[model samples]
Target: MSISDAKVDVVKDLKSEDAKWVKIQKVFYKDPNGKARDWEFASRQTRVEGSELDGVGILAILEKPTGPEVLLQRQFRPPVNGVVIEFPAGLLDKNETAEQCAERELLEETGYIGKAFSSSPIAFCDPGFCNTNLKLVQVSIDLNDPRNVNPKQQLEDGEFIENFTVPLKEFPEKLEALVSAGYILDARVQNIAAGIIVARKYSL
Candidate 1:
């Protein structure tokens, strides 16, 4: 059944303090060993009724004479207290498809407009910690396009995202450099970087 068609009645309100984006709840479910257990988990309470995925992550690439370059963002996450290298991403708006969200977020955060070529299967950010999930979208940006010549970001207030590009061949080195410079790497970024290295090595 679709999310809109499903019934979701809150049995009880378990929070002492209300959070703007998330809610924690105590739940009972069957364990792997076939036993009943109680557990506490976080849910993204802002999800729209008809939305299938929680968010979208853009894997934007630009082709240059040297090689293909990947677009990345450097932002300071309050939870981590350090700058993190991450893909341009955003929570899906109501009734928005993953591809649409990818295109919009990429342009908003990086000032680069891209065409979404493909999308990955829906994946979870942290299944153990929360129900936050996202679909990774493959986007291509044409440097020859006039619109990208002098693009400008449309970031919201309080958002501080720096956009940068790294050659695909030098992605591993870039990750190392970011780490050595005390920047945290998002897991999705690290995995995609590794995939790029492998694809290059195998000529994929």
Candidate 2:
């Protein structure tokens, strides 16, 4: 379903005084050595539509005459209290496949329709801190495609995202530039940037 057709409602509010989307809990478990261990972790109480995965990150590439460019986004993140440089991403809707989520999120967050070329295995975002995880989907965009000539984003209420593109060859430099400008780099984007560097060095 399109973003406009999707329904997101606050069925109930069970948040703590210091919580919004997450809740913290402590658990005790036995380790491999049979030693008792206790740890605290945070979990999302919000309902997700599809797989239990947290969301999807898109490695969207646009084919341009000059070179292939990767799409990126700049958005203010409350956790960091600063802007972040990240790939277009969003949580999956109920019953939505990874590819479907990737496509929909790309359009919703970046105003670009993309075709999924490949997807990475489901991976954890921060196993030490949370159970949240996501799939990294590689997507392809044709700049000449008429559907993209004047694309428009379909962001949700209170969402503020700015999209931009950097040539694949300059992706690493762009990342450094963003860091120099005080933008936090999302781990998924950092990994993609590293891959780009490795591909160039080895002529992949």
Leading candidate by TM-score: 1
lDDT of each candidate versus the true structure:
0.86, 0.83
lDDT of model number 1: 0.86
TM-score of each: 0.88, 0.86
lDDT of 1 by residue, 64-114 (tens): 878999999888776666678999999898878999999999989988889
The worst-scoring run of ten residues by lDDT in candidate 2 lies at 1-10
Residues 136-190 of candidate 2 have per-residue lDDT tens digits of: 9999998788989888999899788888899988889989988997678988889
lDDT of 2 at 156: 93
lDDT of 1 at 111: 87
Error of 1 at 177 (Å): 1.1
Candidate 2 steric clashes: 2
Q: Output the lDDT of residue 92, model 1.
A: 90
